[model samples]
Target chain A: MHFNMKLGLTLFAIYLLFYCGFVFINTFSPQTMEQTPIEGVNVAILYGFALIVSAFALALIYGVFCRPEEEVNSTSDPVATTKGDV
Target chain B: MIYDVSPTAIVVFLLFVGFTLGLSFWLGRKAKSSEGYFAAHGQIPWFVNGVAFAGDYLSAASFLGICGMIAFYGYDGFLYSVGFLAGWIVALFVVAEPMKKLGKYTFADALDAKFNSKGIKLAAGISTLAVSIFYLIPQMVGAGVLIQPLLGFPHWVGVLMVGAVVITIVVTAGMVSTTYVQFLKGGLLVVFSAILTILILNRGLETKSNFKELGPVAWDALETAFADKEIEILPNDGIWKDKLDSDQRDYVVSRNPNDPPGKITVWKQVKDANNLVRLLECQLLETRAGKRYINGLPEGTGEGQAQLEPVGSLSKLPDDKTETGPLGAFGFIKTIQNSEVKLWRDDKKFPSLKNGDKATVYYPKLVPGSQVLRPGEHPKFAGIRRDGIFDKLNFLSLMLALFCGTASLPHILIRYYTVKDAASARKSTIVGIASIGFFYVLTLFLGLGAMTSGAMDVSSSNMAAPLLAKSISPLLFAIISAIAFTTVLGTVSGLILASSGAVTHDLAVSFLGLELDDQAQVRLAKIASVVVGVIAIALGILFKGLNVGYLVGWAFSVAASANLPALVMLLFWKKTTKQGIIAAVIVGMVSSLAWILLSQDTFKSVYGIADAQGVVPFSQPGIVTIPLGFLTLVVVSLMTGKSKS
Candidate 1:
């Protein structure tokens, strides 16, 4: 497996957990979301901003860590392997 | 509110249109071949393509609709921003790089790359067209909505203008010009939005809803004026009209039982003993005779005519502070959380009218800052706040759709082909996520600012961002609006380009086995672009006044259901067959579309059939239809003897 695809999957999973936490809080523990731990900003606003910022952060991590285009293309599967079995 | 047409807006708007057209014409020479027309010959700079991604993705719905929603209903609109930006994770980590490696032009190309089957081409091509057309409607409607105030033109005129301009953009240079236009618009939108956010934070919070330059007058002074005998609460009678003088003290004008038919009761502004002011609500009425009236006067700001006054303001601040000095980002949010905002409630149906006259009233509703900051306040998501399982499911389905939908959208997917390779595509997507995410974060402030701007047009939530700009300065409003119009133009051109590619490349050439040359393919695509552009214009004009965000939500659902399952399975599942992809695409597309059409929302809004129950349990189909798509593909693949590749 290519290192880039593996790293991409890992970052994607981490972000998915963060995103799910957001949805779960909004859905179930909505009262917790209303709590303003950060002065005027509630958990909901803070969480929303965190999710957005984290997406870019994850993408930057992937961009920085992934192999260059030439190296990946040379060793990458012809079909460009993803998570599921082929 | 009266959207007074400004010469500044006109000049700025015309300059934007002219510059867009000029850019398209100048770049027209480069895209003479099919590769250039379809994918900019995979030569767009990664950075440019990334910003263009923002330009293409942040449609009128994201800018106008979401901000309007937030302004009116609070944090629910920002929830949409979170959902929308979250979709980029799927686009970047899963779809972008692989999509660059496999596809040549449209989304269909990637899906059909492994299987040279006509079924794949036909099914994927149809899905592309369906999603593109559905997405195009909101952009078109948003175009008209923006134009009405910016250029003083009617709705249809705005739709026509956007259609014509976008058609020229697509037909002239295709993806090359579209890419640059998107990049320019994307960059301006982000920069200006940041500047707007800064201005909002600097203006800080004020208790009084400042309309025009009217500062809060002392209650003691107002009490002295109201102490006159001219102050009287009159029952519905002709006597109320005689006392309706500006010099007189505040009085209540009750509805007259003997009032003429077709005349709706008006809400009059009156002062209470406490001197707490309740603003007069504006009503817009359209009579059967095609005449329009605003607040019982002809719809104009001329003598004897009435226009809606700008609304929305903070009724109370923390510590009863009349105003807070310039705030930081956290300070702004904190201030709003502790203050009370006066948002408007739109009442469309009034029973007083006897004739066939339609009336929409905009009245104020004061809500606590905490409730406004919380989710589930918007009517669309109000279900989630309730114990109803179906409503919760509806919200969940929409969130899921937004997460998956970005990767599947034909227009967005086609952008990968504009970049050179997997690495560039990855980088471009990263750039896209950064800009789009930053813009979305700014949306919260934009919405909250507009919520407290006290210059809102209660009639249309779509005008929040532009109207917020207007509250700042006319020049800023003009520039922001011009940028917004270009936002619509960039998105519509991308959709049109995607549609044309599907038609000429997939449906015409691949599905029908037409051996067309590169030049011929480009020509056919141009012709297809014109045809799709025309259809989009008509749909845009037709769907005017529908909430731009709702239509976009439906588009996302359809895209996620139809394309995502098929694309994902084909990418990862070696057992996936061409027949499986074909079946999945068709079923997913049809089912989602059917679910939307039959949903209770459609029953009320689209069909106008009150009291009619939808067949589906919920409005959004993503939760059901997306999994259904995957299941259908897997089952069909097993039955059809898989591993075609």
Candidate 2:
């Protein structure tokens, strides 16, 4: 497996988990988001901004880490991984 | 609602449009070949392509729809920003490099690269066209909404103007010009939005609303007007307009014979729990008439005439401060958390005392700052506060669509082919994420600024950011409006390009098995762009006055359902067959689109069928349709016995 693909999937999973936390909190414990965790900003506002910033932060990490590998494996030969049937 | 068309705005808008057209014409020579026309010869700079992604993604919905929503509804609009930015994460990590490596032109190219099947091409091509057109409707509608205030043109005029200009852009230079235009607009949009946010912080929150300019009568004056029969009190037909009973109603309504028939303009006299009087303006426009009218007179701010004044404001400041002068970023939000905001509420249940007129009263509702900063303010996100499973699912479904939709958008996907190499694609996507993320963060401030600026149009949330700019300065409004118009142009052009590519490259060359050379294909693509542009314009004109944000959400749902499952499974799972991809695209597109059409939102807003529940469980179909898409693909692939990989 290409390091880029492995790294990309790992980062994706992490971000997805973070994003799900946001949706879950907003849905279930909306009162929890109203708490002013920071000096003036509430958790809703704080977490929303954090999500936006984290996307960039994660993208920056990916750009810094992904080295040039064989491009053909990533695009032309996408079926490199033979996973189980869905 | 009749904004005095500023001469400065007209000149500035003309200059921006002129510059864009000139750029397209000069770049026309470079796009003679199909490769150059469709993909810019894969020569777009990584940074430029990245900024173009911001321009393309922001659309009218992002800049205008989101800011206006945040301004009016509070933090719920910012929820869109978070969801939208998160989608780019999917684009960057999973889709960007692979899309760049596989496709030559359209999104269909990438899907068909693995399996050169005509059925896949046909299904994917149809999906691209459907998704692109669905996205186009809102952009075109937003364009018209913008033109009304800037050019003093009617909505149809605005739609036609955008269509003509965008058709010119796409036909002349295709992707090359679209890329450069997006890059320019993206840079300008981000920079100007930052400036606008700074101005908002500098001109801090105030306790008093600034709605006096529209000349709302005092409570005593309303009583006098009612006594003199200048206006009549509407008897409550059992529905209270903003907590006021029919006997307790303070505002009066009157319509003269000289006023445009079937049009109603409302001025609200709202008294809070403390009996503090607040004035608000609202309008229910009937635009089928030949001439525009506001408050029973011709639309203008002249003698015996009135306009819908700006509405949103802070009714109370924290710690008895009438105004918090020049707050810091965090300080601004904190201050709002402690203050009371005067949000306008619209109720359409009232039938005008006069015969055959539909009246919508927009009254000011004072809400705590903490509530405004939470998620349940807008009806779209109001589901979160409910215990109903379907209600909760609605919010979750919307967020899911927004999270998964970005990587699936056809217009966004076609952009990957414009840059050379998979590495450049990856780098440009990072740049896109940075630019889009920063802009979305600014949307929070822009929306809050507009919310507190007393410069919001209650009738249309799409006008919030531009009206906020107008409040700061007319010069700023002029520049911002021009930039916003260009924002629409950039996104529409990209969508049109995708549609055209689908027609010529996928539908004609691949699916229909046509014999077309490079030059012929480019010509056909240009012709196709014109047809799509015209269709978009017609739809824009047809769907006027609908909320641009909701339409955009529906587009996201459709895109996420149709495109994401096929794209993801093809790349990750080996058992994925051509039939599976075909079934996924067809089922996902049809089911999601059908779901949206039959949803309660459509029943109420689009079909005008009141008092009927939608057949679907929720308005947004992503939660059901996205999983359904994946399940269909897997089941089909297994049944087809796919092992070609």
Candidate 3:
């Protein structure tokens, strides 16, 4: 497997672990979810927001690591490189 | 029910429509060929296509439906947002690069790429059409919901207007125009939603104390009236009495003083054979110039009519102050976490008629902020609290469907073709995820904001966001609503375009081998768009009052079951065959669709049949049908593996 693909999948798996854990916990342990992990912040709301933020972070990470080596060498602008590919 | 045609809203709406149409016409000149019409000749920028992806994906369901759901049901509505955004991970990791590397116009192109089989084309084409049409229903319904309040048009008129406008968009420029329109609306939606969220945070949480006091006063009067039959109640107390059937069986009424004068509240005294009143069923009655309006409309009286005043207040502040004014994002959520919110609960009962009007009442239940911020508030999500076996399974199934559905949705998949290559597809998917993810986070605030904005229309939960916007200012309402209407337009256009591509490219050319020329194919696709638009309009009007997000859940389940299994197998498994793909698509689509139609939710909600008559045990079919799809594909593939090249 490509290093980029492996890294992307790794991040993806970790993200899913947190995401699915939050969901399962919410389903099975509603009392735990109702608890405020931080001051005035319920676990459910905190976990939900975390899941969304992690998705963006992972996407950015994947974009950086997964960019084709040839394109990286040829152009600095990712958009320009993609536009030029056609 | 009290919608007056807003001239400002009408002007803004007209301008948006006119601008979209004008852009479509200009873009149409460039889309003379099949490739340009269907895929924009793969020339669209990755950034633009990415935002357009958000535009396409964030349909009326995400904006209007999620906001409304959260507004009414609290944290459970944001679960839809969570499920929705989680699906992007599947799209980005599993589907994006491969999809761009394979297919050209429709999703069927990718599935049929390896084998070039007619059965694959036929099965996949049908699935695409089915999913697209199912998805279109909600967008159309949302359009009607928006039009009723904004332009004061009836529901069907809004549906027709959207159908005509979207059909024009698809026919004029296809993917190119659809892409730009989605980009425009997608950007506008996020920005305006952020502005709205800021306004909500700045305004902070305020108490609507009138309803809180009214509840106690009404309860006291009812006790007194039941005790003394001849007691004269003061009009200022907003309590009245009516005796039924000359038996002098008195029932007390409590009117919403917040409502306009002449609205009626009916209290029915249910008496047993012993002539003793056993139960009091409160029903809201509204007679506007002689036309009886029950539960915000003349047609449906059984629907709940008790409009509780917006009743969320800051119970405890983070700094031990009364209100944490103008809190940051984290602070905003924290403030809500420490507060008490009055969420209304709809009491479900068989519709009862009173004095020639249908009446029902929803009682407001006060919930602590901790409870409101937690999962399992909505009835659909009650299992999260109870942790029952079937409830757990249903939650798992819904989550699985949502996670898998984004990659399989025909409209979302077709956007891959609008970009240049696999790398562009990857970048665009990333961009789309970022934009969509940010918007979804804002949805949590937007929904919670609307929940306490004191401007909710209890009759339609879908109107929460627009009404919340209106609460801020009329101009903001017009802009947000106009953008929301375009949100419908952008999504419906993409869906119609995908459906048309399936008809022209996959079904006609691949399955039937018609051998049509390029221009003829584009023309044929245009014709298909019009037909699909009309079907969508009809379905939209038919499912008029159903929640858009709930309707979208069905679409996701169907897509995940039908398309995801075959696509995943073909991409990952070595022994997958054309016959296997065909069987999987057919079985998955039919079974899920059939399951939804037969489920208990459908029986009680859609068909109005008794729950006991419902055929299916569960409402969601993802757990069963998705696995069934994979199993069918594997078995069929092993049987037909010898024939594989």
Candidate 4:
């Protein structure tokens, strides 16, 4: 229900959707994956590398938006709440 | 073909082992209490823990296995890299913070935080030990593989050595030593891999056409010999000399025979007018009396018997030149994309008399750069090219397990406890993702480089990265191998720690309600480490010669099936009862383990039975067992919901 959790889950969904599509297309249409999507690069290599890069990009985005607010945080307490939930 | 033990390798390996042991001893003094021994007293810096995270996760599978697969099978091997990195996303978003909040020492601590039930402790503890032990096998097996070429030791010796060293590391300092070892090795692995990739690009591609000058008689004779009776083939220049009993010949003969042979085989190398050796060739010398003959094409099993001289060349260049000299990273991929690569394909097998009992010959197949860069080249992924429904499901199942498995691995999960807090855990996961992602990208180039480096050993694909480094320089080879050996040590230490924590913290203290002092607990964990280390050594020696990455896959499947469903449901679904978690963990672990044991791959590979005799229809169990776990949890929770309330 929190904004950060929503953002995290949505981004994860988007990434998984693209990743699963790439995998399915490669499985069903093997010839299509073999075709060069860009000059000197086929669909499989292009999409596979893209998935790896996208993970870091998404992680950076999550880290930026999900920063813990200092006012609600306590440094002394070992189990301080971050943004929401417990 | 014989891998002679190099003095440089011995010195570097000794230095690495000495440094690791010395660090363990130094860290041991600080790890006196239970918290310090098990969780580093929650004192590790986020960055160091992050790098240590990479160290613990990379294992031998990512280094030796992925590179070897890519070297042999082209782009298909990089698929594992993609799957492995994607799993980190799951860890970063879903598991990192909650695990740090809930668990104290082991993965089971997190799972049983809400409900302090004996059943939860028993089930989750067993699952942790199972997954950790399964993960340990590949790391130990990889250690043996590395030792064979680096130390010229037998595989069992390598397994035993790794077991003793890892036990010493774990028992001495526990998490403190494990964290620092992982951090050190993790940094070295990334740096050296980058250097190796740079060297690969700088060397570019050159035609090593040593086999091209073989006279037409040799070719025709080989073909005729394959089609008809075994016959002697000679060079037209009449400069042939018997190279039998040589190291090259001896290496080829050392492999185990697939079947008995009825003939004697002789091999000779052709020399030029100047006495320079040009080509090595095999010939059937004679047949044994009253023996049945099985004849076809020469098998590729024998070393140097049926191999074409390492023959990789650039069929096309970006600038249409003979070679692209010292290209940039993008330029390297682009040139490889445009160029034709002579990838080796093992074609047929035939009985041999002179070489090993069978000779399996690999022919050089010139693949267009586009095809080589694409997936579906590996036999495990051949179903991707086919339109069969089962094949498609199998691929999807494997991907699902990999994506979910990262957060579920017991060894990876317990690292969160070593950090200070949830925020540190999250930050460390991010750092881990970045480092691991960068290393994986380099694997693409490293693998493709080895494929064309012409340094590939036709027999052991596991030696691809080290052999590629060897082709660049012997010193680099020694350093890379020593780093690889430490890579095994770091990962194996982490797994042993996780297994020991499960035994001492979750099972003994939580489940059995054992009251103990910190010293007593640390002592129990050390004993557990030794027991688990011995088990790992035995399994590693038993399962010799398997691809470490593939073995890691089975571990991933089991972890995803057994751990993920229970953890996810318990966190998100409030109605989840202790009974539900216990039932789910036990069912998931047992069913997946049984399914794997009954699968076709296991039947053929592990049991030495016909694959078709397997009870399970498919090899991977995640597609079936993962959902079964969640369903069992939901059903059991609902049935027990009223009683708990």
Candidate 5:
């Protein structure tokens, strides 16, 4: 539970940072409408920032929602850990 | 020194092929079970799998196409690089973990995992095959493109060689060998490309003597809205005779609708006995005729080597002449940005080539130090400048493909499965992003370097980067060209692997409900690989001279449309009914495909007509098709699945 919460918070923070960076640069870029010819590298960098944040955001969601590891005490039911698990 | 297509390069390729094939054999021995063969028991480490993602994703299109595009077309080609990389963000965020958790083996598995519906499987299987075949054409075409210069062989020979080698790789090993080979090639591609970038930086920038240059030769090509004319200009460099002569050179030129009308002046020449540059001027004339078909422009020069001020020292020459050097990567942009270079556009053509009787100027005179790249020099991006809202929408629609296609590619999706679990999937995706991102940055340099490297093949843009290398040193040229040829090898293997998996795992096994033994499944996969390999070879030959990147765009749109909706809904939407999945997959796949078949690309490329009349309103189908797919699934499932209660 703790790890999941921490992961979520970390992801949210990263997402915010990236979103802000994208917006800030986009707002300030004098000719964002001019397209990739003049500032091709910058356009790539901005989009990349957005993607990074989202990738991590999805990662955190997965981490938080995923079933945590179960204790082997449940293995008392021998059939549970048997070879036919598939 | 024009390096021999050295025995060393050939030996290197054969050795690489042999080693990889041997590895496949060993791995095949261990791949006795279905799970082992299809997914490697999901045991590959995140790091290895990540590089393999690069291996799978980079394909010949990424390496050869984008680099070549950037080499010749300037920033327009980099748009593809940007589009491809941008697509990955969608994959990393939306698709990776969900895809890993939902289903096993093929894309159809997830679509049918819930209701065990044959309809979903059948639709998805067909979609996979269609998309895979579309993707394969470009790789095969790339194989042919690289073969000509690399081995002094013809295009068809290259295509055949690639087919044979890739089949052996896939048949012997299946995904096991495919993954490792990708990992290996992926690493080498990045490393060598980085090395190439460093070399470019070291060479700095320079000009070439006017004396040593080659005429800008035009191949017998089909042009849209074209005319040919020539004019004379003063010799900018000392190489040309002071007066024009009709006897020496025969310059062939053509004008397209996107080009200016009258004949601008230019010279055709090789720079410093290496770089081939065309110095062009803006044409200003009205349906006028000119002399100099042979003189072309005897008093003037063709778009020849615009004085590359001579890099370092002129080879075999005394210290009497000018001493300059090659520019760093992106140096051409700087040369144009500064007053250091006065580059010309194509001068052999007219000033006002008409598109539907309207004046169209493809290359506008941007005096050196202008603040823009080639604005409408390329026909594909003409949408960027077309007046009215529809043009803007066209540009936006194309962007949609670049954005959505990455996240949805089946080959890229399967890489997430190669790693053990979802965490590894995420990690691997991150690494892939980093590696892919870095390479894209290098493309900007490699491309502009080729564009102004005074080494461009006007007849075939595919030849841009290799020809650029040839301009530098034949030895460096040989190594770079050979490496690029191997690039096709790495990418094609991955696409074949993905398609073969779809055949054995999705279509034959799941959809048909056919049971096969483990060994039998492996055999089926190998056979399927060979069959697909043969198809790719045939199509590659059929589609020569077409841009491989444009070919990949169709693949991206199809993959995005067909696979993405089904995969996403299955993972996230609990009520995504199996029948709904079936409908979504079929509709998404078919609609996007139908849209593409009726697209301008099909008109121009597949059917040798430039008529946009029969074409659909849009260039890329992903924007509409992807959303429509989701809607079809949601609406159908909501109406159908709920009523079952």
Candidate 6:
């Protein structure tokens, strides 16, 4: 698979967004709000959104950093030649 | 409830269902290839697939359940819509691209892509089926609810019909037909709803006065009939009034008792000369010219914000359920629920309405069935306030499901596979979110419109929005109602597709060590679809009268608990072994299942058990099961890693 720096940048930005969410959750209190919402929507919604965003970021991060780095040397496809019927 | 369904409703409903299945069957004949059965050969255009996501995702719960809730509870129902749409951000940013890149056939394929372990396939497959079955029950039940009213048929017939149709669609063209069905229904739903919204803006809101005197004509008729007789009455209590007389012009309108005609209810008062006391009754009547219908009912008030001026899509919003004002995503809802806002209840009911300063509301009387189903007289977590920690835990758990389940749904994951590339998948998700977001905004209008329209059936809250439309024009009601029917059609079809994939691809081919070729796999899938469809039908009936969307809440919690942790671990935790995968899936699935069955909701709702027998305090298992699933996965992975290479 080709590596795309654009994807990496997008993921990093989302990580920052999640960071903001975590920070905001600590900073603000539901009691500070005009109405105390039930076990419903809160700033934590953004947190929920952020958690998934970071999950994607972390997933992309793993793909980028954890995979065994290989040379861009093999243009040939092993599965194509073997034809093991996947 | 079926009485509310008009003749136009049945014809429109049947035509739409017929068209859907016909397309599926025609597509089925050409689906001889394996590619046709799975991912529709991954050739669906991204734009159509994008809308198809709406069709697949917006289940009966979205259309009927939320709309009904909003009609009854004001803005609370729209909260569900916003939450459902917000979850799409997770799908767009995190799931869409990666999910497409990794998986083929089933969600199990995505989770097991890196490892290719038989254990992952088996466990993932089981979880997929569990979630799919859980999700399927609500859709089937929604079908029954719609059908019971629309066709004058019982709820089970509707469930049975939907199950049969969906199974045929899945058995025939598999995802090929399912994709197109969702695409069609999704497109139809958004378009019809938009048209209805435009009509709403044009019609505007008209205030119906709650105070009017219909006593003279009623008394005249009474005096002519019983002039010489004296009737016994409660002294200084309730006044004796003549029985209601029908408005000659629209007597037909008052028959069904389903569609209450347009009535401007003005308060009526009677003075008893004998006692020197005055009695007031909240009597509303349909006026022919300037006269009132005494015995006959009033017309169903028109739906839409009759009094409010149109605030364009992005203007200073009314205190609506949608993104009204500047509170951001949930700013409006948070302000209303937690803050002190103008909440009105009728004096007759709350007796609190006797306070002359408060705004008086004429809530429709609570009927027998309604009393049973209404969300327990207080919040599901009232126990929390009253030192009931168990109930609080239950409420916390349900929220957990809503929080986690959005990203883990199998039908949702499979949509990514149908798209060609990661970029396309991401783009499609963005488009889907925009569409879903726009529609959720409409739901607020649709719901709140029904509330003040005085067109709501307090009995079946789910029917409020549709009955609101029927108040406007039958033609518009017909088309929109058909679209609502197709909403069930699309989601159920998608679910059946997911279940079929789990059984055929993951369980039979991948896990069972079967060497069958593609044709046999497709055949087995088709057969499995029938069985799954039948099961969905049975579940739908058994769980009827429930808020379909709320019922799906359980499914969401279970999916998040059982699948999300396992999927997350497989990718990030390198030490995760096959045994760990199996154990985690088993523990997560069984624990959540066990907890849900023992939960108060199941005991009270499903088994018809009284409150005393309710084992677990709260109904929702999310708060407990979700964390448990994650912990089990982590701990098992750590323990098992010591020996495995």
DockQ of each: 0.34, 0.39, 0.40, 0.36, 0.15, 0.11
Which prediction has the highest lDDT against the true structure?
2
Chain A TM-score vs. truth, each candidate: 0.79, 0.81, 0.73, 0.75, 0.45, 0.37
> Tens digits of per-residue lDDT for model 3 on B237-322?
21112323233433434345455443444444344455444333233435445665553435332334333333333334444665
Clashes of each: 2, 1, 1, 11, 46, 28
The global C-alpha lDDT for each of the candidates, from Candidate 1 onward, is 0.85, 0.86, 0.80, 0.78, 0.62, 0.61
Model 1 chain B TM at 0.91
> lDDT, candidate 1, residue B387?
84
Candidate 2 on B1-645: residue-level lDDT in tens?
A: 426788999999999999999999998767787778888877889999999999999999999999989988999999999999999999999998778777788888788787888998899899999999999999999999999989989999999999999999999999999999999999999999999999999998897665431223455555344334333433334333454544355454434344456333355656656554444545543222455444544556656655666777887888888988999999999999999888887776654434355555566777999999988989888888989999999999999999999999999998888887898899889999888999999999999999887778778889999999998999999999999999999999999999999999999999998999878999999999999999999999999968888799989999999999999998899889999999999999999999999899999999888887999978999999999999999999999964545
User: What DockQ would you assign to candidate 4?
Assistant: 0.36
- Which is the better candidate, 1 or 4, if ranked by TM-score? 1
Assess every candidate by TM-score: 0.91, 0.91, 0.88, 0.86, 0.75, 0.72
Expressed as tens digits, the lDDT of each residue in B363-396 for candidate 6 is 2222221221122223452343344556545544
Q: What share of the true interface contacts does candidate 6 keep?
A: 0.02
Interface Cα RMSD of candidate 4 = 6.2
List, residue by residue over B27-95, the lDDT tens digit for candidate 5: 767555666667766768898888888878887788778777655444566666666776666676566
Model 1 spans with C-alpha error above 4 angstroms = A69-86, B210-231, B236-288, B353-356, B642-645
Give all candidate RMSDs, comma-separated: 5.8, 5.5, 6.0, 7.7, 9.9, 10.7
Docking class of predicted structure 6: incorrect
Candidate 6 chain A TM-score vs. reference chain A: 0.37
- Model 5 local distance difference test score: 0.62
Worst 10 residues of 6 chain B by lDDT: B305-314
Residue B183's C-alpha lDDT in candidate 3? 95
Model 2 regions more than 4 Å off: A72-86, B210-299, B642-645
Lowest summed lDDT window (length 10), candidate 3 chain B? B236-245
What is the DockQ (computed on Cα atoms) for candidate 1?
0.34
